[model samples]
Target: MFQKVLIWFLLSAFFLTAWPVSAYLPSDPLYSEQSYLAYINIPQAWDIAQGAGVTVAILDSGVDINHPDLKFNIWKNSKEISGDGLDNDDNGYIDDTSGWDFVDSDNDPSPVASPEYSQLSISHGTALAGLIGSVANNGLGLAGIAFNSKIMPLRILQSDGEGLVETLVEAINYAVKNGADIINLSLVGFEYNVALENAVRQANQSGVLIVAAAGNAESDQSAKDLNIEPAYPACYGNNSGDNLVVAVSSLAVSGQKSAFSNYGADCIDLSALGEDISSLAYYNPAQGLNNYYSYNWYGTSFSTAIVSGVAALAKSKNLSLDASDLTILLKSGAENIDALNPDFKGKLGTGRIDALKVLNSSLPATGKLIKLNQSSAVYYLDSEKIRHLFPNQNIFFSWYNGTWKDQTVEIVSQEKFDSFKIGQNVIIRPGTKLVKFQNSGRLYAVSFNGLLHNADSLTLTELYGDYDSRVVTIQNSFESDYTRGEKLSGLTYPDGSLIQYDNSDKIWYLEAGQKRELTDDSLVLNGFRSEYIIKNVNSDFYYNIGRPIKNLESNIFTYFLTK
Candidate 1:
């Protein structure tokens, strides 16, 4: 007879470098067991205000809908009927009461049973949700940054943690339409799709902030092979003035960048607590695992969720601020991480997000301020040429065939006019009158547009009006090709081209080559419907460089962000 080994768990302090396994044990749970709260500067985060009424939409594998910590915050689409097998809201989804599952063609987006990782391990989404907003100070499991905030759980990725572009787009659209204040996407891929970019732009335009994981591919420090780009969406820049997307990095106990975390000065925006962070695990009653309420994981994915939760807190306090302002606040509030390379400064953005700084600071009004560098008269252009200009003044210039055209103009005052030169920079004082110049001349203006890039060029005709407007034209070409607000139908594409559904009958196609369209019933073979449809398919090509793009089976268990 063998005496059973009685495992006696003990509790301990939650040290930055130390794993909080003991703290996670039910006996004497410590605040450090709540990774975000213990590691993150919470007193600072709360000064701004707990994420009160804001809603963060988690677009990942289906969350354990019945989790004790998450039941209260899960989004419920009251307008959409549940289990009736009918599209009640007329939004294409049928019975999407909680959320629609793109991996499986059913309304109940629960994790499936599997051997690789127990189906009970539908812990990824639940853990992510916990990071965003678990019941705080309730003397239950653990506390979340935005304990008061709500969660719109969108099941875009499957249990195996795989996702498709179509499902992602649909989830994004849903988040925007459903009033999600912040969107957390801990997924990453390489392929660039125009439709996806457009969808992100649309969401930002709608004032919803987006946060993504910076990826876990350890930084490439070799001088010859240094990697400057992190991952997609995180790498994509927003045309809107608002800073819509942020790429987050992880920090270790020694305050150094985690070895598995990815960092790009140009691509990454900020850093957050990610390594060995603890959060809720899915409940498994059958295994007598009710006591195992929390688990520790690492990756920028967790950091992204923390930032999203902070964004929710910000939104709850100030409902007027748009996505751009929120991004500025996060960037401006971050504390520098010592482990980061000096070369990454400013490039990695303002630094790691400081929750307390954002909560306590008095935010500026919604619009961004344009501060002309009064000390510097010469501004560097993309061509490496320097232009002499005055501070706080707007200018117009023309470019033809990629070369500066020799035509220019100087409108000194809003009420006064001056002769214009086509190629030279024109300086305009405040309240300047508008004048139209003939020929296809491009107009350039600099304004504090809340965009990362300050200056923009537009066509002369677009600026043709008595009153100066915020919207300026950058191109003056008069081709019959698609102009602004023009709609066409029935486009065709080649076999290998990637297609994105635009409407019932149209699709936006993209590839390395030129843009084309695919029509007829062939669209069905490629996977498209007049209405939104979700299905798991098989493809050899990786949807994302590191992950499989498509699923081979209906039931798959994948992880979202790997360490």
Candidate 2:
């Protein structure tokens, strides 16, 4: 039945427009009630905010920008003139007053038939657009989740429902550059593209929220399948802070997972209504009568659009929300669907999105998008695998160029280097900023407040607490800035102190500059805090990378080795 409904969705992907080109307010609604808004409790949400002034970029087939319901809500590239056949804004697009169509490589992105037997071409985009932002309370067909948000139409897929990853990547880049606050992608592809992945990362860097479909499948898109090879862009990355992508699966009206909707804990972020959904539909009739029809749509695509609308509304209420804030905002406010999806469990994500709860929740807004310090960086284990997010972005290594490129966080030490040599798919991330001493040329870093203190030597067993303690690992060290990883016990260093290995008893020693008698019980080393940082690499790669150590020191850093 779900497949049958999905086929129904695809077959009518576009209702050929038979009505006047411009959409006008309708006298009657097709549904007995705006059940979705009532079902999703959007009225309560709207009491707080409508999606006013936010721009949602829709990268679908194309939209009926002239449709009466969407004409006013459609985004206009005010900088570029339309039909001039020129790239007026010098932004690589000419006359893209509305939006550009990548499939045809043209400026007029209105949906049209070309790929032969394809009803899934035009209407789908228009439907998605109306779902995101159709003029509301004007006696139109249906009120969208973010009825006041603006929709930027980027026609990446062809009329025949065919689109390439390359086109999608370009569309993402275009959306990021065009001042898009939120991007809605209702399509899906099987394979992952590196270029596309990087582009999505860049979008997050630019602070744009992304909403994508978990996809419709004949069978359940189980969490296992999704985690193994998740949907593209949607499953890009779901780490805390700086995450832009929110993957959504569909939930039936019964509050159960849709049989055809994909589900995954790692990728899928929210569950929304997908069954018997209603939105805009366009049809070009033989008689050329009224072409626009109020149609009830189904599938995850529509649900994805609905979620995007909710995000827009949230942003509308809280204007200071960055991409990361919006991402966390939607998730934190989600109504967990775990009890209903007991068989699927966390795969459905933080459950269905709650507009009212999200609006009422005390999630704070953020002005800064990119992190600026190592203390603000974070790491987590997804699928039992380590992932990282940092102020400087991900870890990077450059041998001669001295330019840092995006690199994954993998910790390694000099002792562990021989087993898995560098350049063998190794990504180096330092525990802290490693600063080079002015004269020694050696790089060292500290994780704590770097309070200058006289050295008080303690035992490896006493100083570290436990040898097998998990905090002893680099992963724990990075998270707590070596504060959790190390135990001064009662030892306090007024100056910045560090744990140095003695190599004799296989024990660790505390070294700050305190000239104490080197005893088996306690030992002290002589070194100033700002002189240098300690590093193992001696190559000519010009290894200079560090953040200010507050008022204690400037331009200090640390590095960790990992493959």
- Mind giving the per-residue lDDT tens digits that candidate 1 earns over 1-563? 21111101111112121223333222224455555564557746675677777888887766766766567877788888777888888877888888667667667655543445433235566778878877665545666778888888777665555567777777889888877888898877666666677778777656678898766653344211114443666777732233448777666665566666666665677878776666766655664335335555776678788888888887888876557667777776787764455544444455777777776665432111211222323221211112223222222211011112321111121111111111222222111122122343422222111111111233322222122453333222311111222111112221222334323333433333332344444333332232211112112222222222232111111000000
| Per-prediction TM-score to the true structure, in the order listed | 0.59, 0.64
Off by over 4 Å in 1: 1-30, 115-121, 218-230, 238-242, 284-292, 338-340, 365-563
Clashes of each: 36, 52
- Go through the candidates in order and give each one's C-alpha lDDT: 0.53, 0.60
Q: Model 2: per-residue lDDT, tens digit, 1-563?
A: 00101121321332323333233333325434447877777878888999987999999878878877788888899998777788888989888898888878888677776636355445788888887787776655656778888999998876666677778888899998888989998887667777878888777656678888887774423323477767777788664433448888889888899777777768888889987665776545532424575455677888898889999999999775656667777888888878887888988878888888888876432112122223344332121122333322322221111222333332222222222212111122222223322333322333334311111233323433332321111232333332222433333321223233333222111224331212332211121221111222122212122321222111112222211
Distance from true location, Cα of 547 in model 2, Å: 35
Query: Which residue runs does candidate 2 get wrong by more than 4 Å?
Result: 1-32, 115-117, 219-224, 239-244, 283-290, 364-563
